[model samples]
Target: MESGTSSPQPPQSDLLDVFPQKGLEPGDIVVLVLYFLFVLAVGLWSTVKTKRDTVKGYFLAGGDMVWWPGLFSVLMLAWIFLPIYIAGQVDMYAGAIFIQQSLHLDLYLAIVGLLAITAVYTVAGGLAAVIYTDALQTLIMLIGALTLMGYSFAAVGGMEGLKEKYFLALASNRSENSSCGLPREDAFHIFRDPLTSDLPWPGVLFGMSIPSLWYWCTDQVIVQRTLAAKNLSHAKGGALMAAYLKVLPLFIMVFPGMVSRILFPDQVACADPEICRKICSNPSGCSDIAYPKLVLELLPTGLRGLMMAVMVAALMSSLTSIFNSASTIFTMDLWNHLRPRASEKELMIVGRVFVLLLVLVSILWIPVIQASQGGQLFIYIQSISSYLQPPVAVVFIMGCFWKRTNEKGAFWGLISGLLLGLVRLVLDFIYVEPRCDQPDERPVLVKSIHYLYFSMILSTVTLITVSTVSWFTEPPSKEMVSHLTWFTRHDPVVQKEQAPPAAPLSLALSQNGMPEASSSSRVQFEMVQENMSKTHSCDMTPKQSKVVKAILWLCGIQDKGKEELPARPEPVIVSLEENPLVKTLLDVNLIFCVSCAIFIWGYFA
Candidate 1:
């Protein structure tokens, strides 16, 4: 059963005593400090070399785009619908709450410190720093998780012993607790009864896929990474790498959770509300305690510290990413729209300022998030996304594939779907899930209809509304759309149609089978690309230049002047995934990933 509240008490000191655990040792502190220092050093180093004033340089990691239309969809299908990002960190917000309760530390202080660390690196080096730090975090996360998994499996006498203990505990829990705060007997099962299961079969099958699609394929937050790759091959290769990484969560996070439940049933699976609250400070349940609890309880001092560092790395990595992206979107897309003539220095300053603003907003939001899902981090995030993302997914999928999807249709469809979802969100907040022992006196629709199911209904509404509205409106001209859509991306004719009608510079003489461009035409062509496609800096007045130099120096940039950079080719947003070798590799990888997923679901099922 779901439960939530508006106010959360600070984590209790006796948290470590909940399941007979020792406090963090000095080595743990040293490891954590070292990790923080390393990340800060790397971020600042990136800042020294970074040109933060430019859009592509700042946000895109100075890399180009590679569009994916398949595996990312599958990637979404795996934990979210696989383990997914800031959301990962926000999910960890609940984790932080648990850690606070267990370690008896001030969670608010931890939150502020993390925000400070994340913002500093993020504001300094921008996207590149986020990427590099993420790589290091990934390695640390993998090592820490695998190390703990090994210990957990050994402690429980391996898989066979794990299952025996878990089912025994599960059965005993039901006998005593009955329906109150007892996990479903089909807890390990991924696909179960749509109506009764927390993860309904129907919702798992189709409903959750909608949001995953939006997140993996469409959301700027994710696609930004793909766009940062140098070429399409590298992009797909990066995706394949992500595909491999996706396999880690179940083994590392989810299964370890089950192990913890078995090992500390009295605490992790505390049935009584008062007893449960006494254990980890969440009356609803202590399911969120599985990770940090295991790390603290199982691992010895040094490894425990390393694991702590991993958690912090994950938290910081996610936080920095979120801050970087929020700032990028605000500065590049929205700010530019508001001030088209804004100078580069002004824009960079605004973007860094925006990161600070986001930190303030996130800090303010921590209490609401922790309380909303009864300290269940993943659930809170999913419930929120189910309300907001399905409509966006519907618009994007339709817009990309269907030529008839027009701006007016998208605008109104989004407005309608959002209004509906917002109504649900407001209601969900007002009618929070009651404690397990409390009467199930919730509204039928709110109580019975799952968020995943609602996702579908909302998506369907958006699609139909958009389609019907488009039919009545004036269709966009083929020329206006050009090669932006899947329907037109491949044909060179449509690609040409997208290009403006100005005379392209002619190369007069043939040299080594390549035409040599005339000097005048080449110069003319460079200016055209800068003005039309690239984010080039404008010349500043003497006084403005002096201030810009001072600002740049303060931000650790080398110079006040613009650098002459070669024009890049226009980005290809949609491409046919028709390469034989690449397709073969992807196919093989997909099969492996899917097979692994099926094995996991079947094991749990």
Candidate 2:
């Protein structure tokens, strides 16, 4: 960040604590620094390999963007938490990793350093660097997780042994207090009490699914990876990879968390606020600390260092993905809108600079995020998304499928839904949840109604308002909605209408439907077009110095030599594979993924 502030400490007031307190040893520090260096090297290498001067190269690598399944987003979570919380539509986990942070380390060091490394690689190599580094990060995460998983299974015996002991622990906990605000009797079950449980069956299966869909399917951060892939086969394979990886988290994180509560019930399942404060300094039980604690207590010193690197890897992977994607949205979508005539080089520079500003904003938000929901990091994120994201999900779904959704209806619907969501968000912070034993002072809707349930209500309200307003207003043109909605995605007629071949720049400069142009307007238009050509063209090589050439080489900016870039025509791509063998494999993998999902739900139902 811009200022040297105190690093965030592990939750002292309310998060759960388990590991024997320790500082970063010399080995850990060395390993972490080395890992950071490696990531930086990879980014620089990628920058050399991939084009980066254009928006597409920087944001999407040197390939086409596509429509990837939401499952694709959460693929890395099992390795790092199986994108389960992410698949489950959890928010940024930079804060989650800090729940059981190391002793004597500044929170800023972890958060800021992570963001800075990611930004360097992103700004240097663009999306190519991020993807390759993510691959390495995913590998490290799985190795670290499996190491902890092995230790946990060994510590508790096998699955059957753990289950037997888990039941015994739950029974004893119940004897102390049936309603002890500790781990629930149905802790292992996915379908819990509709009103009392943290994740009600109805909410998990239905309400939470809304925001989850938006996160996986529509969110820019996750989709950016897919868009960088070479073709439809590669994208589908990548999503299948996610599904395959997802099957491991319940084993990697969830079961390990259960084992934590069973083994260290006093810490993970603390019932009294005083006892909890003594344990993790947070009155909330410390399930979030389970995985980290397992690593610290079980792994040897070198392995501990490796796991630390893995945790850092996970943190960096996520932040980089988010920062890069956010910059893309800001530079292309928002910036381009504001300055429609701005040059491509200007867009690239602004995008990189925007990442630094985002880093500062995140650093500032850390304190506020830490205080939210009393230190339940993942849940706080999920609930906020519950309040704000369902309406966006509804709008996206309708805009694509229902051809009548106009800009006015979409814009107004967002404003209306956002206002209501914000009211709930503000009230949540102001009238905070009371201590476990104390009476809740908040409104019934705030206190009693689950945020997931609120999401459904908000979604219905948004959809109705949007639909009604659209019905009374002008409809979106067929061309406007063409190839966007599900029904129209495969229509060859609409697809053909979407993209036209490029014409000579001179012809395009004066080819607007209004043929009659004033002499002054024509000259001004040519001047603007010629200026754009100069900014993008490499014809200035004879006048350029060594420093500028070096900067261009390092950033992977390929000069256009003698050829000017044609104004691109975007084509609607069919994501399904055409190759018989690959298509068959994809179909089978998809079926297997769905089967696994069904099996998990049924086993826990």
lDDT of 2 by residue, 419-441 (tens): 89889989898887776667777
lDDT of 1: 0.69
lDDT of the candidates, in the order given: 0.69, 0.68
Candidate number with greatest lDDT: 1
What does candidate 1 score in Cα RMSD to the true structure? 8.9
lDDT of 1 by residue, 471-573 (tens): 8999988876666677776656443354332222221112012244556655565566446533334433344677776656544344332234423446555
- Model 1, position 105, has a per-residue lDDT of 72
